[model samples]
Target: MTAVIEVQNLTKRYKDKHALDNVSLSIEGNAIYGLLGRNGAGKTTLMSILTAQNFESAGTVKVFGEHPYENSHVLSRICFVRESQKYPDDATPRHAFKAASLFFKNWDQEFAEQLINDFQLPMKQTIKKLSRGQLSAVGVIIGLASRAEITFFDEPYLGLDAVARQIFYDRLLDDYAEFPRTIILSSHLIDEVSNLIEHVIVIDNGEILMNEDTDAVRDRAVTVVGDKAKVDAWVADREVLHREALGRVVSVTVLGALSDDERAEVTASGLDLAPVSLQQLIVRLTQKAGAETSSDNQEVR
Candidate 1:
């Protein structure tokens, strides 16, 4: 697969803070990628730079083999749907869709109309008067219907309810099957989008923590549940991410893949091995990273 977006030692600084710290990664074309991280972790910063909405303080960024800044050709092929996207005070959902149709050459008016009906959005009502969820629906509709070569959805559906969000996910997947394009989605609802994303990129404190296929990430950790003493001994030499104890029982999540023989040995030892979900693994990894950072700060003090 060819890389459509590439970064080399990219860094974005805000005053004394490093919004992005020497980050380097490549995004392949025609795949769904989850740009995931906690708040203030640089997910939005990276997306903004890629979409040419913000400038990088240092290093290089390329979208479709060219710098995105002031590059109309590259910019036109990309669509960015942000949660805080603003509109004209008098603009309505209908007006927004019409403008998007003209901007994105691949925009599908029929699909946009379908989404508007699915969300029960009022076409004539001014965007300023719409409810929070309705406003989000507007962005969701534009993002899905635009069908740009690369679409960045930065938590644009936060205001949507569960059912409405499900509709967005379903429609996105269905459309993607027919028209495959690169999608980079950033959201706090990791579990909800886990299945939809083909790859995962995790950032922490302006650094890239993990970037890999979703399946590979899932196997990066496993939980073992058994008697407290047995589980403790079993994981003593392993890198443990998290641990929980209840009476005589213990559950320890360790980072590493078990071999076939090791798996049998674990089962033979009467311990139950459980697969760690993507959300669980990411949470543990970020927590561990945060703790290490704190320790380093304390040492400097």
Candidate 2:
């Protein structure tokens, strides 16, 4: 696979704290990657360093096979959209779209205007006068309409309502099908984007934890249910994420999937299997002990 962006031995420090520690990652071309983690997990730091918006304390960053620092050729092909994106005083959404058109060679003005109308954004109002949701819409339109070779969206839906967020997701997928490119979306809503991303990169405590295909990560954890005695025996010596018993029945979540033989063994033991939610699995991986007793809470899509 041709890596569109590569980072080696990357590290970033803020005083005594390490924002990123000895990180090494490669992003392949033309695929949607979900960048996920809890708050303060260094997702923003990593993206900023990759896009040349921030400097890394140590490590090498390359985009399109060349160093991205001060490299106009590489920078021009990338669009970084975050909630904190800024505009000059008196500049409105119109000015933002105009600036984007001049930068992205593949900028789609029609698409931008359509999105503006869809979001009901005011084109004439100064950015300072717009609401938080309106500000988010401006960033969304620029990110989508820019059509950069690689687009990084770092939690750009902060103030958007459920409907507007869904519109962004639907529009993104539609446009992406026709104009494929690298899109890295960082979202706190894991289940919401579960099926949208082809791969997942999880960061926690300023370090990379899991980087694999969306399906592969799903297979890494599983839940087994059956009689408490049988279930306890079956899960012997295995890592258990959660456990609960109702009357004579017990449900337990374990760290690995059963093999073919193990699957047959489960049948023989009268055990039932239920798929683990991706969000739950990741929550278990990233949260502190006893911090979250369950992951059944659903997110607004």
Best-fitting candidate, scored by TM-score: 1
Alpha carbon lDDT at 223, candidate 1: 99
Q: How does candidate 2 score on lDDT?
A: 0.90
Tens digits of lDDT, candidate 1, 1-301 = 9999999999999999999999999999999999999999999999999999999999999999999999999999999999899999999999999999999999999999899999999999999999999999999999999999999999999999999999999999999999999999998799999999999999999999999999888789999999998889899899999999999999999999999998998899999999999999999999999999999999999
Candidate 1 similarity to native, TM-score: 0.98
Shift in Å, residue 44, candidate 1: 0.7
Off by over 4 Å in 1: none
TM-score per prediction, in order, is 0.98, 0.91
Residues 190-213 of candidate 2 have per-residue lDDT tens digits of 998898999999988778878999
